[model samples]
Structures are given as C-alpha cells and as structure tokens.
Target: MTERIYTAGLVVIGDEILSGRTHDKNIAQVASWLQVQGIRLSEVRVVPDVIERIVEAVNALREGYDYLFTTGGIGPTHDDITVDAVAEALGVPVVVHPQARAILEKYYADKPGGLTEARLRMARVPEGAELIPNRMSGAPGIKLGNIHLMAGVPHITAGMLDALTGTLEGGAPLLSETVGCWTPESEVADILRQVEQAHAKCQIGSYPFFREGRVGANFVVRSTDEGDLKSCVDSLCDGLATAGFDFTPGGI
Candidate 1:
C-alpha cells in the first residue's frame, strides 16, 4: 500500500479580510504549492480576528488534517490575535521565542534606532513551537505542532510558506497534462465525462481560454502518480480522437 502522506488546510484570520478591506491571496498560493507536494487542500475557512473564532478554527482543522496553516493577524496591531488564539487552541502559552527575537533584533537594532516593544510583538510564538523563517523579513513565523502561523502580507506569507515547505517531508509530487480542443464543451461533453469516469483517480478539469477571437478549451488531467497521469492522458487523447475533435496534447 502507498504511504498516506500528510495534508493541510488553511485558515485566513483577519477582520480586514472578513470586512472586504483586503482580498486574500494566501489560499491560492498555498494550495498550488501543496498540490506540487502531492498534498491536497481538504478545506479552508476565512474568519474574523475574534480570538474565540480563530481558536475554534485552528483546533478543528488541526485535529482533522495532518497540517493546519493560518495566515494573517500576526502583525503588531492590536487586532493581531492569531498567535494568542493559536496558543489557546493548542493549550499552550504564547512567549517570545529567542531565535525569533534574535532575528527581529538583527534587522531592527541596526536601523538608525533600535527595536521597540511594538515591533517585538512579531516574535511571539506558542510554547514548544518551532520558528518558521521569514525569507523576506527576519521576523520568523511560528509552527506549533501541526499548525503553521504566517504573516498576512502576501509577500511575507509566501516567504514563510516557502520556508515551511522546504523543511517538510513530502511524498510523490503531483504531475499534470493538458490537452486543448477547439470544439465546444457541449459537443465533447460526453467524451469528457467518459474519460473522467475512467480516470477517476485523476482530476479532470475543463477551462475555457479565449485567444485571437477564437474560443478554445483546455482539459487538464492531474495526479500524484506520474504513470497513472500519463496513462489517463493517453486514454483521454484516444477518446478525443474517436470523437472527431481536433486536439493538441500540450498546453500554452
């Protein structure tokens, strides 16, 4: 039997996001990254900055999934309660991690001035948590058990996620193949359905892309098993050929 690899879900916590003040970009990036590692995103929730709400989401997702990632609400502002709630959810106390503090001090201490208490807030981590290095800024994120706490800012969040993924143990990586057909989906819907049913283990998705006043569709087949993916693609191409639809085996 193939080993059961770990999977992760995301929790984006912030009043700004819930209020529509800021659009979230973390979920999509994180999803794509995890997909490359053969880890599926089972679920995602966007919650406000309320401590109870954050704690509840963290606890639920952490228990159900192999990993839980929370983005936003780790800033210095008063509304940044992600660290505190994560600690609460895990029954741990929040404390300034020495390594995280040192990272912060290195950057801020040399600036014409010195690090302040407000800036130091970024170094807080749940007890027994390991620090996830921030690739951009020195202020590291925190990882407590299976929960990864990251910054809300897109660049910083992306950096933290990169750092976390770099250190994680991964299973087989996902592979993808795309075939484009000029024919309308309605004309080829039946063939697509048959191919999908036959390749149940692979994700078969149809996306429409318009170019040069012509509408075309792309059928993507993705799977963690490379051999299975190629086999499914070959079968899909054969099915398309039998349907009399002109198709290309590769995508743009």
Candidate 2:
C-alpha cells in the first residue's frame, strides 16, 4: 500500500524578518520539528506585519496543506496582530481563553508588572482554539483545527514544538543518509542523478562546500522507506567508487 504523505505549510509573520532586522529561524526549526513528526514542510511564506497580508497567507496556506503553522506577531506589542489576522482568516472572533488567562495570571502573579492588559494579550486566541504550552515564556502557542500559531523566538518555538510532540497525526518519518566526498559536486552530478533515477522512492540532493583549501560535496539521499534509502545510498557509493572518487561514510 502507498503511504499517505502528510504535508504542512509555514507562515512567517513579522516585519523584522522581511526588513532583515531579525533573521528568521522559525522556518528551519519548524521544518525540523515537522520532519520528526513525519510531516513534510511543503511550503513557506514570509509576510510583513500587516494584518491583511497575514490573513491572506494564513487562509491560503491553511487550505493548501494538511496543517498550517504561523510564527511571530503573537506578542504583547501593539504591532503584534497574528491572532487577530488568523481569527479574521478563519471568520471567527478573538477572545481571551480562560485557561490561557489563568496560566498567564499564575505565571506572572509574583513577577513585576503582574498580568497587565498588555501581558494578558498573549492569552487571546481565535475562538475555539486550544493552547500549546510554552515553557520559556508565560504565553502559550495557539492551535485551532489544523492551524498552529507559535512564537517567533527560536528557543520559545522549540519549547512549543516539544510540547506538541507525539500529538499530531502523520505518516512515516522521512529518513536520510549522507555521503561526503572531497571532490567538486559537478564531477559526481551524473552519478547522483543515475542513482536517484534507479531508486523510485528516493531523492538525492548534492550540496557543495569549499573548505580547507579544497572543494567537497555532500550527497544526501532521502526516502520514507529504509530499504529504498539504503539501496540508493549503496548505489551512489558504488558509482562513486567506480569513478575513483574518495568519499566519506558521513558528510564531509
């Protein structure tokens, strides 16, 4: 039987990311987390802090993939509008979730500036959304149906991802094997292509690097099937050996 492929889309929402002020790390972090969950991060869209753009991206992505995740614009600041945008996209109203508010109140009860209105803003969510715990901060992530709203900070996002582990439904996790060689990627292009072609369910990616005054390349083979992945890697290694290319077992 053919395994069903589960896919996800990511919307990176922040003016800082688009303006280059803050480098966006959520894309890679989310992609890695989804990979472990056996879900493919199929597409990503970065938009400014504008609500209209965010709403458009959110609606479009949520419809196109099995799951949709948004990062950024969920903070306490006035410019933070991800929740509002998502609510608009879903045609729902925003409300302060009781549990979320209680969490924030408890988290900030002893701290300075305890649970002010600004801080309470973190507790707001689109109607009927559930909370994803955030251990790094008082605020929690939001989940409504297949849509997930996460924090922009990498470490905070990591915490949210950890909380969501083993909760999402997915297919087989994609597996990968890497082979490195101290040769230019151009030299092994044909070998890579031929091996990938021979493996129906496998894909080969060639990444080139220059280091230690030498050109090197790493070939990555990815597949959902372990046997197919190993077969493709073996075929690639064999072809490289036949061509007299010295390669390493793992990436160089």
Candidate 3:
C-alpha cells in the first residue's frame, strides 16, 4: 500500500500583506518546516484582516487538508482578528485561556507593560484551543484542532515552528536533485517526459531562465525515496547528455 503523505494548507491573514505594505515571508519558512515534519504544504491563501475573510479562508483550508496554519492578525493591535475569526470558523465562543493568561502574566511581570489589556488579548483563543509556545514574544501561538494560528513576524514564526518540531505524525520527507542545462526546455521536453514516465515514484519539474543572452533550463527531479531520487536524476542527466547537452549537477 502507498504511504499516506500528510498535507497542510496556509492562510496568510493581514491587510498589510494584501496591501503589499509587508512582504509575506511566513509561507516559505512554514513550508520548509512542514517539509521537515514530512508534511507537504499543499495550498496557501492570502486574505485580508477582515473577520469574514479570515473565517472563509480558515474554514476552506482546514476542511481540505490535514493541517491548516494562519499567520498574521494575531497581534495585540486592533486589526488582530485571527483568533476571533478562527473561533467563528469552529463555531465556538472565544475565551481567555487561563494558562495562557497566566503565561502572559508571568512573561510581562517585569516588562514595561505589566500584562495590560492589550497584552492580555494574546491569551484569548477559541474555546478549546491550546497554546503553541512562542519564546520570542510572550503572545503564544494558538492551536485548535488541526488549525495553527501563528505570528506574522518571520522570526517569531520560526521560534514557534522550533517548538513544534517532531510533534506531528507524518510520512517520509520529500527529496530532490536539480540538473541545470544550458539549453532550452523545449529541446529536452521529450526526454524529460520519457524519463519521468519510466520512473513511477519520481517527478520532474522544468524551470526556464534567460541569462547571459542564453536560454537555459533547470530540471528538478523529486521522490520520497532517496535511491529512486538519485536513479531518476542519473537517468535524466544521461538523457540530456545523449541529447548532446552539457548539464550542470546542480542548477546554476
């Protein structure tokens, strides 16, 4: 039987992200982290900070994938609405988690704010959600069902991801090898299809680029099994060479 590969979806929530005021970086990092956990980042949607929009995105992604992650709109500011929206999506009332409040109280005891109302907002979560530790900031990430609510800040998100490492159940990590060629993709299209079709467990992706006034392409071969991955790469390289093209081991 084929192994079950876990998949995740991401909903990036913030008006700032949609407005391009803040360049979103959470997607790439989250994707990399999930990959380490053997889960594929299958889908991603960027939505404004509006509660209805957040609810829509959250419900859609969570229902389709094994896991769903949201970044942004979880801050202390007025526009912060991820928690509320997620609670709505789950059809649960928002409540201030006792442990979360206590954590915030302890975290802010010596800080200048001293766990003010604004800071306490971070302690609120969906009725049954749990906390995902945030070492960088006192405001912890929230976990409800398969949905994870994280920080918009890349560094903070990294910290949360570190805390979550090795906790999720997953299958094997995906592996890939890239072969770069100083030739057009069209020239090797048939070779790529032929090689990929011969390998049931492998996939090849073609990325074309123009540089130094020359057309070139990179073929990335991927598989969950290392041996199959290498075999596919070697076969692709052989095919390219037989077609009279000099290919680079790694993409340029």
TM-score of each: 0.91, 0.98, 0.96
Worst 10 residues of 3 by lDDT: 13-22
Tens digit per residue, CA lDDT, model 1, 194-243: 88788877888898877878878999998877888998999989998987
Residue-pair clashes per prediction, in order, are 0, 0, 0
Model 3 regions lying over 4 Å from their true place: none
Give the better candidate number (2 or 3) by TM-score: 2
Highest TM-score against the true fold, candidate: 2
Please say which candidate is ahead in lDDT: 2 or 3.
2
Instruction: Give one digit per residue, the lDDT tens place, for model 3 in 15-47.
Output: 888888889899999999998899999999999
Superposed model 1: Cα runs more than 4 Å off: 209-214
**By descending lDDT, how would the candidates be arranged?**
2, 3, 1
- lDDT tens string, model 2, 1-252? 889999999999988988899988899999999999999999999999899999999999999999999999889999999999999999999999999999999999999989999999999999999999999988999999999999999999999999999999999999999999999999999999899999999999999999989999999999999999988999999999999999997888
Worst 10-residue lDDT window, candidate 1: 164-173
Scored by Cα lDDT, where does model 3 land? 0.92
Root-mean-square deviation of each candidate, in angstroms?
2.0, 0.9, 1.3
The 10-residue segment with the lowest total lDDT in model 2: 15-24
